[model samples]
Target: MWTYLIHGEPTPGVARLLEGVGRALEARGFRYSPEAEAPNLVLNAITEENPKPYRRRAQATFVASVLELPRFPEEPIKELYPYLVRALSNVLLAYVPGEGAAFLTLELGHYREKEGEGFYERVAERLMPIACSRLVIDNIFVPDLEPELWEGDELTESMYRAGRKLKEWDLLPAPFPIEEILPPEDLRHVKRLYGIGGLSYGNLSVRKDERRFWMSASGVDKANLKVIGRDILMVKDYDPEKNAILLSVPPHVEPRRVSVDAIEHWMIYREHPGVGAILHVHAWMEGVPATPFNYPCGTYELAQAVAEKVREAPDPTRAVVGLKNHGLTITGRSLDEILERIEGKLVRTVPMS
Candidate 1:
């Protein structure tokens, strides 16, 4: 799962040293085992820990540790730990030189899942700005403070309890999805959706899935939202004949024009498959291109520029600051992921003078 380099005083009994390393690792959510028993001369002995564990043993070396992640070797422990220890050994090392054993612990923060879709890379690319943002809420505001048990894809009350306990440990929620409390009229016909946003800053509307790409009725603000039948706005339903072609226009509305942003929303869905939802905002310094367009202004150049920007992006799913002068487009299987990106991007930006 992760790796850590522990530095300490060498024990007269090598076996004791091994045991101490194992216990230290276990305390910090890692496992360790000695690799060479007394026989191999090259190494003293070996052992393994839960999840993933590794050990290194060589004669005349007090340097030993537990490793689980594959990418760790590129940045081995012996070299990294000493520097960390030189600075923190006084407070962190567990043993005294003549008294027995002590190790300077070097833990891998936040294990990144490496097997699928460059998840860690994506997180690194996307969250860097948020990780260093100024708009971050105080650690006290973090919700669900404990480690959530995966309850078949849904979090439960017990999980909530665990989170509360974790709060006692000071580990706050690192990221959460964005939420907009919409009104009843817009949500009446909706079955399922990912992202939710305020209509008039309070009334919320959600995009529908599986049937049509219907959104919420216009003029439904969240503050005074009422769950009435007219709030739902069913824009398009599944044709089952034309390969999922999306259609707009309700045919009966007065001004006849639905949200002008709908076409831009559709363009994103067409370009990126598996995009569950889209959030288009007309924020300042965003949503306006720097150069002039030759045609009706909705040119292929914008889409190409966006694709290129994301392709070159450090994180594919992250929201770019000033994408082609357009606001921002984020995608995710869940709404929180998208929201986290939004908040993170906002935090990363420094106000321009």
Candidate 2:
């Protein structure tokens, strides 16, 4: 059994948020105990100003301070907590204006035995959300394309159809219109694609030009990517000298880093210009050809290997390359084309090994 404790004074709205979170956990068999027992989680909602120098700050004013418990019992619980935090934060942000900030802290009893102060602090940092605001932009900015150049084309129509198909197939949580989410001036150079997931994993992209593109901020939920000004980051330039990619974000939007797999996507686009859109899903493609090398996700090695495999494929436009032990990366001339290929290959019923 597990328990929870609340510290600090929270407003009526925040109180309700805590209660709702408790109910969510309780439904999963967690119990509440006033006693400070082992295997319990504590929530500290600090309404007043915190004086601590090390307190984490929110990217925007919507959240004042946020802390995550450094410890958990095990795998499932560890995974579930981040989702809960993300859900709660999303709900809170809806009510909070740009000027308002809500402070929250999560403490775990399991780590109490750890002696070093730095140890717990390090743990808390790791558990915290990737960003205070769901939408993040980098510091760079690029010139926008002329409006006349942004008129709908065959590729745009294909992208729109593909977005709808992804939503229909339940790969995207909701319909995301590309035009609405992106600036009109940026539309001509941009072609977008999205995949759904909870707080931890998802993929989205904006092909800026033939050679460059942008991707979703790391760890953002796909369902929350309804609009563009906030949820995505534009890759301005890649510095091979530093092995770094430069990003351009919207004004007033703080720089949120790109996904770990950004390199992989970059590699694909650089190697295959015919591949206009890419869709990565966390499912197996049993019979599809995969990379011979088993590199870990997000590594440059993996990116290079996946791109090499994709390049070798006979049909670059309709290629499906597996990441050895990981998921599948599908590419096509357009999003609609990718969807058509995926629809044919997807197993409607449970898959047997």
Candidate 3:
């Protein structure tokens, strides 16, 4: 059974709602636990007046904060999204009695309601993917020979230039406002845990060799990637034994984790040798095939689903696939080729399901 934790204070309405949600989850095989033991998910209920965060834990722990908004705003994104992040939880659930509820993750923003009944069951259904998926984020760094690999290689230069192009197109969304949103103590915890100052959207990578590629570092500015180990690192391979992405970084510099989506990229690269490069952006394209479910990033399930979509494409090397409630993952001969093809055809606002 999957273990979970529900924390924070809630109002009468939220408590009753949580009771139903908890029961539904248990019926579907979820066991509640305390903070001391590692749990698969944590549902944090917070009040607007005291929007406190749960203690930091491994990235694998999915922390979703729930809040009750009286007569929830018609446009919650503009009116009340900041407070959700203020809770420092990855997913936010905003609920109202007569009006229904809305859901927001670090990725897409989705609003849902039930005119008839079973709203609680629907909410629990939407959370199933996140509650079940495993995050393959463990990383191993080796001080392997090759300053030339990460320093000034031609492919590496293309990575830098591609980052600039993405910035120019405004494809890279702003990194999360961790410092502005979290308290001083909680802020330190995040940095220490993730080795990242903030979380950002989109990651691009170009093939370095037959088995490896260079990827952007986790939680760094995609627009301005300058450092070797800090901003960009070479993904050597995915280690099944460790269930981690292995990287070859400069021996002198401290290495951070590669993009959380590195496993997804690794799977595609391994499956399609002709596919030379991959570009993932938080933007959409019309008429593109998207995954059926919105699985959490970095999971083997998501990787397998996206890879299957690419495999089904007429040309896996040059295909554009949409990630439902997420964005697009494009494959091309190089980053430049991917950039050229997607120049005029991109939807900035990704549609949520």
In candidate 2, clashing pairs total: 2
lDDT of 1 at 29: 49
Ranking by TM-score: 3, 2, 1
**Cα lDDT of model 2 by residue, 1-353, tens digit:** 54445544656755654565556556555565645433234555533233111111222212222233223324422433332233222111111321222222111001111323343233223222311112222233443423432332344344445545655666642222334433443333322111212233436454658876646555555545432334555565666655566665544444455665777788788777777777776555657777653343455666777787788889876688876534578877766567667785663221211
Model 3, 177-285: lDDT tens digits are: 7688777887788777655567788998988788998888888889877777888888989989878889888898888788989999999998889988999999999
For model 1, how many clashes?
30
Consecutive 10-residue window with the lowest summed lDDT within model 3: 107-116
Clashes by residue pair, model 2: 64-102, 137-255
Tally clashing residue pairs in candidate 3: 0
Better of 1 and 2 by TM-score: 2
**Between candidates 2 and 3, which one is better according to lDDT?**
3
| Model 1 agreement with the true structure over 15-121: per-residue lDDT tens digits | 44435444544454443333323211111221122111112221112222322222333333343343322221111122222232222222211122232343324
Model 1 global lDDT (CA atoms, 0 to 1): 0.29
Candidate 2: where are CA atoms >4 Å away?
Answer: 1-164, 172-199, 347-353
